[model samples]
Target: MPNSSEHPCRITIGDDGPLLVEGPVEVTCADGTVAVSDRFVVALCMCRRSRMYPWCDTSHRRRTQPGEKSRRDTG
Candidate 1:
């Protein structure tokens, strides 16, 4: 895992998709709702099609069909 003092949480990009986040982490939604779990390690969905919000449900794999890059580049 890449080490960075600025970001205490450790995040790894998985080969199959989903961001694997480990250690102290907090997730906040646009509606001011927050999800915090201690030693929080979980797979988060990069694709916005999850029925279970904020978590990966393997929806990305289906979404990224032929001619799709499975890229969710947001700024």
Candidate 2:
């Protein structure tokens, strides 16, 4: 059940990846470009490497570079 006093938003930190947020969420960039999502849940990138800005596409689970280490999944 959800609490009515709070906005319909929540964030969950991934073990080795993005921050998952319950939405609809609206992201506005520095240039004033806005991105909107009505998804039930949205993954926001933490590694700054996602092809889709303001959204996670599992890019954080991959190696940072060739020969680099990959992140381990703890959950």
Candidate 3:
């Protein structure tokens, strides 16, 4: 069987931020490792630049391109 199972999960997408997921959520790695998060909310990394994989650590706020703007600037 798979290490993890699907269930009803709430998700919120931002125009220029992490994907917010309502937790307690469990995540399993491809190598058979598992990580559990019990926070009321968990932010999933979208820009793939987070040092914390599968989680948001505010890395997305950093400048990525010469003219890139943050959500604060656009919104």
Global Cα RMSD, each model: 8.9, 5.3, 6.7
Residue 75 in candidate 2, Cα distance off native in Å: 22
Give the Cα lDDT of each candidate.
0.71, 0.76, 0.76
lDDT tens readout by residue for model 2, 1-75: 242555645779867788888777888866898999888888888888889977887887645565567555335
Residue-level lDDT tens digits of model 1 in 1-75: 234787566779967768888845568977887876554577777877887767777788644466667565342
Question: Tens digits of per-residue lDDT for model 3 on 1-75?
Answer: 122446456779989779898888787755787878988888888887888877888888756575666556554
Question: Which order, best to worst by TM-score?
Answer: 2, 3, 1
Instruction: Judge candidate 1 at residue 25 and give its lDDT.
Output: 54
Clashes of each: 0, 0, 0
Model 3 score (lDDT)? 0.76
- List where candidate 2 sits over 4 angstroms from the true fold: 1-3, 6-8, 64-75
Q: What is the C-alpha local distance difference test score of candidate 1?
A: 0.71
Q: Is candidate 1 or candidate 3 better by lDDT?
A: 3
